[model samples]
Target: MFKHLLPRLRERSIAAKRPVSLADMMEEFWREPFASLAPVFRDGGYPAVDVSETEGVVTVRAELPGLEPADVSISVENDALILRGEKKFEGEEKKDDYHRIERAYGSFSRLIPLPGKVKEAEAKARFDKGVLTVTLPRDAAEAARNIPIEGA
Candidate 1:
């Protein structure tokens, strides 16, 4: 009956030995009241992305399964690339019996910072087989240039 007390005692003993900061105490004070509701505010980082630079272009690819191209929007603002989209829930069929539904459906927005300036007018995006590919060509002024070394 008292087996659980051992673990609690050990935990308290271990915790008492460590130095605690004011910030840690404050965080614990605030966390206990909202710990049960924490899951509701979690961001799962949906629609994962990959950003790569090759030659004179920067490319970004996002995984958006089960969503049409029309459901998403892409924009470049203030040197950051923004991706916004919503995956609406499908109407449940009366005959379908489901045990568990883990798929996430909702609106999400992701802002990606670019390494260098890009030509927004020349930017192109394509969606194929649940993947979005965006290519932004680097601006002429932002391109890499070889500097000549002068011997004095």
Candidate 2:
């Protein structure tokens, strides 16, 4: 989606040796069928994620509609949470029999960085109702420390 477009836009801007304007966008994908498909090309990809933090835990939820728990893989590396998975559709007939193909089916990997630090060892994850939730407990030393205020 928008995530995939930003990098291409930045690269195009760099290669053009100037800033990208609205007119530039029009001219870049300027063609007969290509021009018509300009918008689709810019917006196409996987689901989005929501992250929240409580006093002791950081939770990550990713939208993965139409997928089973086994279809996705989650891991942690350094300060980043890694998600790897594929969205696939199969039929008893064949792949070419489809009349229309709108849904994206392929492998994707997304790395989300933690807000601060967490105890990866104690992290837990669960997938249910097409939502993947990961709860990461804040590292003991990295947890917020409250300081007492004194009257001067």
Q: Which candidate is the best by TM-score?
A: 1
Across 1-152, the per-residue lDDT of candidate 1 in tens digits comes to 65656566556655886325444455465857676565655554556889999988999999999999999999999888999999999888889899978788899998888988999999999999999999999898977679999999
Cα lDDT over the full model 1: 0.84
lDDT of 2 by residue, 16-74 (tens): 88648654465555634376665675454245888899888999999998888889988
Clashing pairs in 1: none
In order, candidate lDDTs are 0.84, 0.80
> How far does residue 96 in candidate 2 sit from its true spot (Å)?
8.5
Task: List all candidate RMSDs to the true structure.
Answer: 8.8, 10.8
- Worst lDDT 10-window in candidate 2: 24-33
Rate residue 13 of model 1 by lDDT: 50
User: Estimated TM-score per prediction?
Assistant: 0.66, 0.63
Give the per-residue Cα lDDT of candidate 2 at 59: 97
